[model samples]
Target chain A: MATVAAKAGEAGIVGAAERLGVPLLTYAAADLAQVAVPNPSAAPLAAVGTPSVAEAAALLGAPGGELVVQKRKSAMATVAVARRRPRGRLALVGLGPGARDLMTPRAVAELRRASVVVGLDQYVDQVRDLLAPGTRVLESGLGAEEERARSAVAQARAGHAVALIGSGDAGVYAMASPALAEAGDDIDVVGVPGVTAALAAAALLGAPLGHDHVSISLSDLHTPWDVIERRVRAAAESDLVVTFYNPRSRGRDWQLPKALSILAGHRAPATPVGVVHAASRPDERAEVTTLAALDVTTVDMVTVVTVGNTASREIAGRMVTPRGYRWQS
Target chain B: MATVAAKAGEAGIVGAAERLGVPLLTYAAADLAQVAVPNPSAAPLAAVGTPSVAEAAALLGAPGGELVVQKRKSAMATVAVARRRPRGRLALVGLGPGARDLMTPRAVAELRRASVVVGLDQYVDQVRDLLAPGTRVLESGLGAEEERARSAVAQARAGHAVALIGSGDAGVYAMASPALAEAGDDIDVVGVPGVTAALAAAALLGAPLGHDHVSISLSDLHTPWDVIERRVRAAAESDLVVTFYNPRSRGRDWQLPKALSILAGHRAPATPVGVVHAASRPDERAEVTTLAALDVTTVDMVTVVTVGNTASREIAGRMVTPRGYRWQS
Candidate 1:
């Protein structure tokens, strides 16, 4: 049971909390003034130092919950109830590979449902049109993932519906992992999946992933190079189709060639490789080449390099991996 | 240049084709009668044994292409131009984990744009509402993937816009491979990537795929059990997060247990395992258990079993694989 500080000692409210076996919570006028209520008036503020006593107190008592009932005025007191949701909602949404049509409908809906939307600046700009009016957007530049994760979690903790957006499927080398690491069971987390770069690139370059495949990110910003290399070697030894994300950047150019060399050690020099840049976007470009023939210099941060397995082939102009080992024509 | 059999040898048309250095192709009335044209007239049927010869010949001439112009008649001759697309377009669309909201806007748009749609009956039913009014749907039951692939390619080869849909990402253990194998350079193919089962299940079960991951389907229908086991072992030995698709079916219950045993060899018994059944659907159910605690009997064809890597942990009842190798509180 909750009430204003002036009514905390009142007999009627105190008796009700005691009878219900619930703790009585009281809120200060200044604190109550911060909460946005559906209805507000001057009478309670002038007489009791708060515009809303019962409603504000109810909301203050239920952290990360919602106000279910409005104030009911009686002759001497007003009563309200706030329903505590099991937890606040935090939707980690994936915007897909930089195209409006490629984004899932659920991702767009979650953006509209959220009271707070957090993402990197460029990614936020991609979906700004989908957000409803009054949606609060907290956007930052690159390398601020940790801060964005914490901010999204905090907003959800405060009972706001929050959406933390990332490009591609949020779980695959994106925001979901970082955000989930910072999040606890205090909030409900819903992951909305999207088209990752590998799938998008594969679509453009035919079906290089028709069989078993592994995706390894080459960025050593968080993970070490040794770990990335070991995974690449395993993928090569096992003859699994490999999709390399974050393959190269201006600062990290050698990794892609070294990784391709490891794949070449296991695969024939002529094994097909598909390189896709900015898939589904207007400037999207895809090429099918051989492992040995690929010029790593043409690659960059946005490029996805897919090396086909032993059973993979180039039919006509598109790279294709047979679904079965028999590999019939 | 195209014309009906009656006008194939016309002096003016022959001279024009010769002057333009283009070969003139003529279609028989029987073949022209088979093609459905936008404009059908009784005058042509009565006079030349086919309705709308100009439109039909143009369509037949540009196999898998549309008639760009309606029939224009002169006193003695009728002419029409059919623009042949470099190739027919075949869009391998992923419907995304059985939820309409999870379906990408591009997937929906592809469904609307397609003149013909081919898929497994259940997947087709999921997107029937999104198809344009006159769209042709070629739906079949399970195990008819080969036929569906052939039909979609044949439609595109004839210059029709086609969409071949699967439940998850079509390139991942779906129709893309078979369709691509049958498809030559004669048609344009677009892959509209969808949220694959692995990504969809990962989202529902926190972030089990936060780090490096590999997806291997356990169904030996197309792949041999030995190949599947080898891939599973590689995934386990490398500590790569693993997502098992087609984990179990009534007739194939043994594979899931065997695959789990392979992972258990390297992973701790308490390693987190997320089992998601029919993710994002009304009957969707997800649970995070340990490697030893997971009940394979609870899994089915529709289920996705994701086993976290060595770096993965169950935090606050959600499975989370840290993005980095170093552990932190």
Candidate 2:
């Protein structure tokens, strides 16, 4: 295995290899001191035998390999990307709820940086104005999530900078999962998280998420009802504020009612529940109700339902879960 | 209680009142039809025999009060803000996890909109350049969090737009709780959520938060250690990925170790743990290691520690928890 070594004191190198899907190779100061590198520093030369651990390791690992990227520095670490060939990039981006203002600057930059953007047709429409003038957009309809993930990875492997976009935090119940499953080490993958639906809904509903919370999808498309029910039960039993994504749709009405019933079993019927549909969007609709009064028919695929814990309070009209111990209240 | 009524079919009025910390008031068409308003519409008159629902409701509720804001139309609904008096505005803002790019545009807008800004001295320095010209900054040192919250609220009450900022999501273990606790319905309060520390750290560590997770603050300054321990125990027993905020400091080093031991009892020693210090800042440091191997000394108050659940895996050096049932993985 190709080995890489850094100053013994440096901590991220081991995890960096794990991120790059490579084995870490460590060398003693005296050993790395002997290897001549293309670029080196006096600090490392003074601390270790080698002037550059990253460059020296690459040279040592692949005797004839070329240094593709010179050392790039982050705040505390230096990364020297080395490969035998050119590499493409894949960025999994979250668009944040539906509002343009909710989108993180980094997510916007990634969308503009990518040569090709892949996402659901509706999501593409949501961010179409933010894309660079010449950017290519490949959009599909719903139920093609797997195909979109595959296409994004394939484009990345073909040396195109591709951004696979989703609404809300992409890593949370979004495209990051499917894309990561299809991705390999041949491409550089970056995940830019967006404001998730749970957080957005919580914000709209006051501070129901002031304390600990969990986000569970009630879609039951890929995840079974039993599994979703178990998670709901766990959250309910733990006094956890729960945010339900994909809470309901035309066909999925019963699932939400069932899940709410499961939660109702654990807490009082008067527990505050917030339902936000199309958060931050033009058609945004949000309301605070009780578990007993929450009408499941009002929810849809675009809605996020937050159920407060036993300690949560309906103050004025807003649902607030205080960040203090119940005893304090 | 004075009653204000809109069309009964309007779906968002109840939720809007809840968000505004007010009670929903309803009036029948005939009742509102009897009142006169500034802007009369034939449509509402024909449909419900009311000239305007919002204006009529405001006029009816506060019989002698003025309509402060004109009726505004959104895509799905019309809103007319009415108040007994001119109120100050308070926005609890999150600066994201140290990176300028991670900050949402709404957060930036809030900074620009605020006539006064309140935050920790260091945090103010981080985003001082982003503030609009003429904005007054009230910066304080650590241990004065309560003081800052009071100052922000006081400033807002004085009729100035105030932004109380904190790193990562302000709502998550930051200033939102304290400030909200100090606030009343007199002033308009808006919470602009940011990329929380846990989410930011999770992104740098790959998809460790792909599944459900809970964030717990290990700092004992405000919360008792027994409460923290019990919460940690609940997380461990629930098999949820736990993200520890305020994980460790020079004097508080023992809490993380003790909490990790509690987690170790429920999970294998090999469970992946991600530690990110000063995430997205110039001094940022991130690493992925097993619970058994994580060195507690490397963590400090600036770090966030995420311990994965039993199903989390170290793939290619990245920590990932699948969103599916155990059988699928």
Candidate 3:
């Protein structure tokens, strides 16, 4: 039980805490005055130098908690109750690769369950119809990933059920990482995995990822070029099938060619490479070509380039990598 | 237009091919007899030394194609048409982490659209209710992945829409690699990516995969232990986060420990390691422990073990790896 310093000595308030077998928490007028409450009145401010005694006291008593009941006035005193630990839910939802059908059922359900939805402007537009009528949408432009993560975490901290949506699997080069970095254990976090771009592109290219693989993002916006080069070299040396995400863009033109050249040092010129652009979307295009024959100009930001390992082959007009080294027909 | 050798010289058959502006390809009785036909008649066999002239001729005319029309007999003749390229769709669908909601809408829709669904008996049972009425299900016991893949391809070759289901993303250490190796360009293949076990486990354990990561299956059933070791060592040297799938089973016990030891060589002993069992399922369990403290006995085949990179940290009981190398709080 909680009460103001002056009310802590009252017989009725003391008896209620004793009967409930809980210690009475008393707050000073200065401490209560610092707390923000929904209901603030002149009566408490004039009498005890606080805008609200009951509401502020309730809030102050439950640290990092939320007010459950508003202030109610009685003949002798005012009362309010606060939940000691109010946990808000933050669901990081992945919408899959472009196509609506590719989105998982759980992702759609999370969108409806959330009272607040946050995502990039384009991703939010994709599932705008899925949200409930009263759900608040917090959307920003493409480069505002950190801002979106902050806003989602802040909303969740304020005790609102929030869903942060991203394209592809949230864990794979998407919003889940940034959002998780900003989020603490104060709120409940649920991760809804979606179909990542690499897998989506692999599907179109006749299972080029049938064997062990590694996914590397070519965009060096956050990561250094040397680190990216080292990872690509490691993948090449290991002979693991490589899936290159963010392979190329108008501004980032040289990375894809440079990365492919590293693989070429270890791989044969005839090595199979599958290039997929905008997989599963209406403008989706998938093509299988040899590493030497590939034209880098056709690649773009949305493209995913999968370079097959040494054992990978192009058979019957489709790229295929056998599951084992000693592959038998 | 196709016809039997005996009927090709006939004025009516020749005129019909001319009117249709197509070449009349005539097959001998022996050639026609070699081709299999669904509707075989004794009358055609006795008259031309072949089972059925129209049906066999149609099938032979379109190589690697399907018979769309059965033989229709009239008083004087029989007519049948074979689709030159009867494209049959083979959708390889990933069911996702043993949860109904984790399965994508496209996976469910493909199950309903398929006239034939082939998968392991257990995976087939997971979505048996989602299949449309009259859908033929060809399910086999475990260790029969090859047989299931063959059966699905055969069904698709015979001009039936087929769906092959697997748990988690089909491309990642699942049925897609084997199935695509067996498939040819004869069928239209569709890859439906699902929530891989690694991503699902990562989601439950916070954002351990906030950076570049690699998924390596520890089971040495098809892959050599040395090859797997090399990949693990490469991942460790590159400072990439690693997710171990097929970590352990009753028969295979040492692989998980060995893989972790490789990562421990490069990562700190206090690095966060997330162990998740049956993620997104009712029996889901997630734990974040340091490398030195993790108990390997608690892991099994259904479990996914993720080892964080050098930059990863445990904050408020959740494992998180910042998105950038030089992360500022």
Candidate 4:
């Protein structure tokens, strides 16, 4: 897996460090050894701009000091941070869509190399050991909107390597928007894709995303109800192999049935839908059910509903939508 | 690299032939024995579904002109023709995307073992003796889509070991489709996914397909134009990183530019679009061009355009769309 190190590493900090011919500082001997001479110059100068009182102390390595200084730029021109890196590398590292081996090697490498890791409380614990010792970590557990952004921005500004991790591909409604909005322009963000739940489900029961497929999220937490409805209508009309994410949660169990109605047009009432829960993770479970037999209340946020394309059928015990080749044959 | 064996081998043909449960016959075999093969009963049978016309009449050793007949069941359970005594099996394969190293080991092994080979004209020519001789060969030239499929199906049905080939994932827009379509359902078709072009392009372009990406083809030769338009509209509205296949041709170059006007509402004109021509194959070229600068006429069928998500951008001559995460100072 070729790392999209981009400006995030090689041409960015490492390049600067190389040009200066100095070793970037690190508490870990591994990171330190990874560089040549320890370049103390890479160290933060005490009067660097944009030091909130708290941060000035941190940058100065002033232990136990918390002064409230105003936020300002860290360095003029030398460190023109993006609004946060437009391509702040994001690795949507899939822990599994269940077993770790199923996790692609690329996902493992990104996790091991990330400097600052930001993610949900669950993911932070999942691959905690992969982190290099002494790396700073910012864990957000159900924080308010601005709080998440503010924390992400502050860390990126700190010059510490940071990774905003998410289970599955972070781009799949898990990390893309919020992470982008918070990190600002100077930081380059890149999303690491993992095996998506739909792919796993398809693989488990033979290829399902074989032909024209569409993945839709049922929970309308952030999206307007009308938007969801319109998209579902459009997908159904297109006869797409649809996968519904965020199918149900506490108090949101009603989402599935409502989704069925919105998609009633194209799919026959008896269309096959595979309800997968805890995909690729321990306690993983999956069941094949038809659209008419689907019981939304039994599902939760962990469940991903895969509704087959118009061609899908229940064969034996599996719900499969042959990618048309079967019919062609 | 996984050899997505043609239907004849994958289902039960190989096993049957190995056990001498069925008869087998092949058209050409210059070197039939260097590799390990499970053998069977009588002479190889006629290839399935294809007419018993040209090849069978001219080359078959059977003095009685016996042709293998298929036992078709339900609409979907059909397989290719069955030989009376099958001596060997051939796997039609596709190595998705490029990066030869990414080729699946299974595909590599099968190719290594093939005594006789058949592939698209360019592929057969490119491999340069990837097969051992005296290997009989059938190279399908351009605009000979049906011809290639028929040849592969015919060869496999005859029971001579062969590997039908495709680049990138076999199941997605590769030889697997036509091979199975024309061959009867009784023929066993096994799909081994190589790296899909989208995944390879995404990996090359620094996580461009992170999060919600869509793989949409601009080709409307076999598919209806209206269907193509609807998918395009939905992908744009959903803000997906769209991968366009067969984006242009001599007569159909207008679709790409037309797609721009249709998708502009959802995607910013300045959004980063990576135009990759002949990905993975030698002479592969990729350019980080923005949608605004894209000239449909300049892009031909060889080109694959990834109209990035809202986050995609051109940075330092490379196309990148950050999944969103900023690193602090």
> Could you say which candidate leads in lDDT?
1
lDDT for A321 in candidate 4 is: 51
Which lDDT tens digits does candidate 4 get at residues A1-329? 01112223444556666787855432322222232221222233233222122222222332222323322444431221112222334433434454454444556666777777777777778878878887667777863434554566566556545576666555455554444545544555544444456655554443455566666666565555665566677677666677777777787766677778767667788887788787657787777787888787667877778887677666545554543433443
- Model 3 chain B: weakest 10-residue lDDT segment is B320-329
Alpha-carbon DockQ of candidate 1: 0.55
Residue-by-residue lDDT tens digits, candidate 1, A1-329? 87778777889889988999999888888898887887788998898877787788888988757899998888987888898855578999989999888888889899999989999999989999889999999999998878888899989888789999999988888778878888888788988988889999998899899988999989988888898898998898889999999999988988999999998899999899999999988898899999989998889899999999988999889999987785453
A28-122 per-residue lDDT for model 2 (tens digits): 66665677666788977676555777666665665445777777767886666556544779998989988889999899899989999999999
The TM-score that candidate 4 achieves is 0.57
Cand. 2 Cα-lDDT: 0.80
Regions of model 4 farther than 4 Å from truth:
A1-98, A133-136, A142-156, A182-185, A188-191, A286-289, A312-329, B1-214, B233-243, B249-251, B265-291, B297-329
lDDT value for model 4: 0.57
Q: State in Å the error of residue A47, model 4.
A: 28
CA RMSD for every model?
8.3, 13.5, 5.0, 15.1
How high is the CA lDDT of each candidate model?
A: 0.89, 0.80, 0.87, 0.57
Worst 10 residues of 1 chain A by lDDT: A320-329
Clashing residue pairs for model 2? A3-A25, A4-A25, A18-B316, A18-B317, A19-B317, A33-A49, A33-A50, B5-B27
> If you score just chain A, what TM-score does every candidate get?
0.78, 0.74, 0.81, 0.68
Q: What digit string (tens of lDDT, one per residue) describes model 3 on residues B106-225?
A: 899899999999998989999999999999999999888788878888888888899999999777766777777777877888888888887888888888877788888787888889
The segments of candidate 1 whose C-alpha lies over 4 angstroms from its true place after superposition are A1-87, A327-329, B1-87, B327-329
Please give the RMSD of candidate 2 to the true structure: 13.5
Q: Which of 3 and 4 is the better model by TM-score?
A: 3
Clash pairs detected, candidate 1: B64-B158, B64-B159, B65-B159
